[model samples]
Target: MEEYKIRIVKTIQYIDSHIDADLSLEKVSEVSAYSPFHFHRIFKLVTGETLQSYIIRKKIEKSALHLAVHKNMEIKDIYWDLGFSNHSVFCKTFKKYYGLAPTEFRRSAPEKFHKILQIQSKNGQVDTVFSQYICNIENLLNWTKMNLKIEVKEMPEMNLASVMSLGIANVEPSFNLLIDWAKKKSLFPRENVKMISVYHDSCKITPLDKVRIHACMLLDERLSKQEGEVFPETIDGGKYIVGSGEVTLDDFEQCWVSMFLWMNENNYSTRRTFPYEIYHTNFKEHPEGKMIVDFCIPVH
Candidate 1:
């Protein structure tokens, strides 16, 4: 156990030192004197984060340090210095991780971000960063107060082809499968990506297994199956009260939680029937990850 702890510490030190380099799992495991096969599992067991997530998070931490220390630098320079290939990539990943753009974040806390804010003072000064905390129920009530109309629409039942996977959301590999399947069959035009979650327990508070997600599509008679695949199954459908709103990356968590709360309060409950998310816009094109999607929940 002591030896394992030492290995983890060494790994962390190496990561810190090589923040600007491409640090892969194989290289990290070799440096830490651990086998590549066991490295990810052991690292997760010890640190509660995967190597990729850890590296990205640490990069953000280092970026925060640099931002506080050198407020005059350009955001593009910061992006490159932090090892991102380009400004846009850096912005996307950063927004996903931090929920805000670099400019917006700094603007919100100018004092903490001002490089000379502390040194100019006769006595050592402390500055606080503007931070936003998520209030699940309160924020939802506020949004609903916008009197966002309860839009009712009847959606026709349709068959859908789907693939199931573990994990909470889409990432590279799973998305690759979704895209390849869609492109080969040209499913992107007529059909659409419907992310469905059947929650046996609260995903907000419970373990991951309590959440099951299926990447689905609405199929017309034009849809056909590929070889070695079974018949397309009908995504059991029903009436749904749909509510949608736009959320910038910074407000995603608060907005999502609030929407759920609103649904619960308004008698919109999941019936193990029609429960899904229709992603309407492209996430990559949206600045600060602005996305508009409809949440469909069945009600009694």
Candidate 2:
């Protein structure tokens, strides 16, 4: 599973760097090291959208960002640069996806424009529109008031076994795979195990299909490479700001957002290492179905 996720990540990265170029299935599948047929199926299963749809959405999104940030650039130029063949095609596709023409969207508030991209939900379902998702995320901000505590501490180096998931909504499968592997290896007895999740990309900055989340667990002694796709890595020791709380999966994203906001408000700068979460309560065993987690963000 890690191998498949890594392939998708690499393919998405390739697409991101070459968004203006031709991105046919054959080309993308080649980058992923999977045959076109197999790649198409797995890509859809993992990302909640067919590969072509993802590419089109990304191209349109890029055009939207260009429209919002580059006010002086011509719409035609933006469309062309984003790989759209012509103005009419770009306008039609953009309006269909975002419900707003480029010119009109540019004239409107920037916040609304940023919310234009539709979210690709997991389970092959899109239950809410982009605006509704934003509202839901806004509502989650209230979770910060529920006895959240944060402090700064230094952490020691540790070994980890991990699996990467391609997007936020698609993280559960990776976690499940890792847990199943651990169980099979008898790496249990909760007290001796530490579960952590490392986020490789910020959703706010990266496109959804390109985001990466690493589901990890600490390993005491080095074990030989396991059969399946598990990654063995070491996290460097560091000074970090730790935020602890009981939060449902739905509130997790907002928790991180609030932590970053807190750091900004308190005049702390984040370090180069990726922010991670240390789970104090087992996910399935949470009494209230809310995980007890410590969000650890490396600080200078």
Candidate 3:
């Protein structure tokens, strides 16, 4: 079971980095070191989607994100860049998923995409907490109310020894594995070692069960894979809008919501990359039991 988790995660990382390429089942299964037949079943069982469906969904989501963020990129260009051979087929598939045509969606701009929907859901209660891609805009209040720092700057690439956080309630098990690996590698007791969580999917976008979070530590030099569970993935270094704060669990949600607000207000759109949080003071060890964290969003 653990080996399945590790291999799937490595396959996921490979898919992320090579999103625009020809990602056939045979090629991707090679990354997981599983045969196509077994890989299909294991991936579907673990991730709740057929392998082909997963690839298609990721490609669709990638196109949707581009349409939402990079408005200047033409619709044809976006579809073609994502390997969609036929424009009409691409538009149909996109609308089937997002419920809007490419032009209509782009026109809705940053609004419908970031819109925090507040309506009576099928469950017959007001479900206003999570939106599609971002959280409720109301989550922006606490950041201003508490006056945290939000700034934009250039960030360098981070070389990480990482393991995936299985879920919200299951982070500690993975964190312990990473910490023990770091300790054995003498990565601890060092000034530059930083613990970070790189979010590969937004909470609002992916289910809590399937979202990928890399709980990693920065290393002085990226060592070879000495352990199967601990692998290396590099976080891209470029321009990012960051928010720094001493926060609780709820505050962490607001920090991300508010950071998106900051980006929109400042005329910055997100780059096609993941956001990350750099941890300074551990909440468990802090005097006030709060975490000192930097929330980073990559942008063009």
Candidate 4:
């Protein structure tokens, strides 16, 4: 079952990282190295949805994030890029997810996403409770102004040895696994070896229980190999909105909000890429349990 978890997590990560991969059931099952039936069973057991359903759910959630934040991205771009067969299917799916038409979602973005990317769930009960703090934390901009020297910088491309961790709750366990493995391979020649994480799905849009994050260790150089739980992958070098600060786990959400506010005020939009964070110092090792980190938002 643990092996099944690895296979499913790796397969999902592969699909997200590639972005252009064929999404047909046959291809996905093949990628998982399991028979179609077995793949479906395992994937559903791990993710709580069928593979196709999971894919569609992610696409729809991502689309909602776009519609909610980036007014410049056309609906057609969202629908087509996410692999919807036609406009009709796109509209139907959009309504099914948000209980409104795509245009309606955009027109009502303010009401839909209360503040920045805060989304109210269909029932308007659960998400409303989760997002209550957004309004309360209006001074995150002050936090940013005081604590972070924000900059737009070019990040270098990286080849990473990564461990896939499901559920955001087990972040420490995931990093522990990666660090223990890295010690065996002697990759940490210095105390400052970079520790990075790429969250495959946004927690605001996706359920916290189902979110997937890759716990990635930066290798000293470009090398590629597949070694059991560890796999090789490259992240793109691009312009990013970056800020480094001493933040506890509690400050992360606020920091992220401040960055988004900063981006919006400064006329930058998200570049349709996965964002990442660089841990300058490990929070677990710190006496005060604060992460000295640079949260990088990929942008044009």
RMSD of each: 16.1, 14.4, 17.4, 17.1
Model 2 scores a TM of 0.52
Best by lDDT: 2
* lDDT string, candidate 4, 1-300, tens digits: 134334555577666544435787788888877656445544554455677787887688778878888889988888888888899999998899889999998888774463544444564333443243232333343566777778999998888888888789876687788778788888864767988998778765567878888888888776567777777767888899998899898878666756665565566877777888888887778898997889989887
Task: Provide the overall lDDT of each model, using Cα atoms, as 2-decimal numbers.
Answer: 0.57, 0.74, 0.73, 0.73
Task: Give me the displacement of residue 165 in model 4, in angstroms.
Answer: 1.0
How many clashes in each candidate? 0, 0, 0, 0
lDDT of 3 by residue, 151-203 (tens): 88999988888888756655667878898877886777578568899887666
Question: How does model 4 score by TM-score?
Answer: 0.54
Model 1 C-alpha lDDT per residue in residues 1-300, reported as the tens digit of each score: 134445656676688678878799899989867556346545554455678888988787667656656679888888787788887887788778768877776655555554532333222222121011112223334565562334546656656665554556542344456556766777665534553333223343345643545555555663466433323546445666776776554554444444444444454555567456666665677876766766665655
Flag the better candidate by TM-score, 1 or 3: 3
Please give each candidate's TM-score: 0.44, 0.52, 0.53, 0.54
- Model 2 residue pairs with clashes: none
Residue 170 Cα positional deviation in candidate 1, in Å, after optimal superposition? 5.2
lDDT of 4 at 269: 73
TM-score of 1: 0.44
Clashes of 1: 0
Clashing pairs in 3: none
Q: Which pairs in model 4 have colliding backbones?
A: none
Candidate 3: RMSD to truth: 17.4
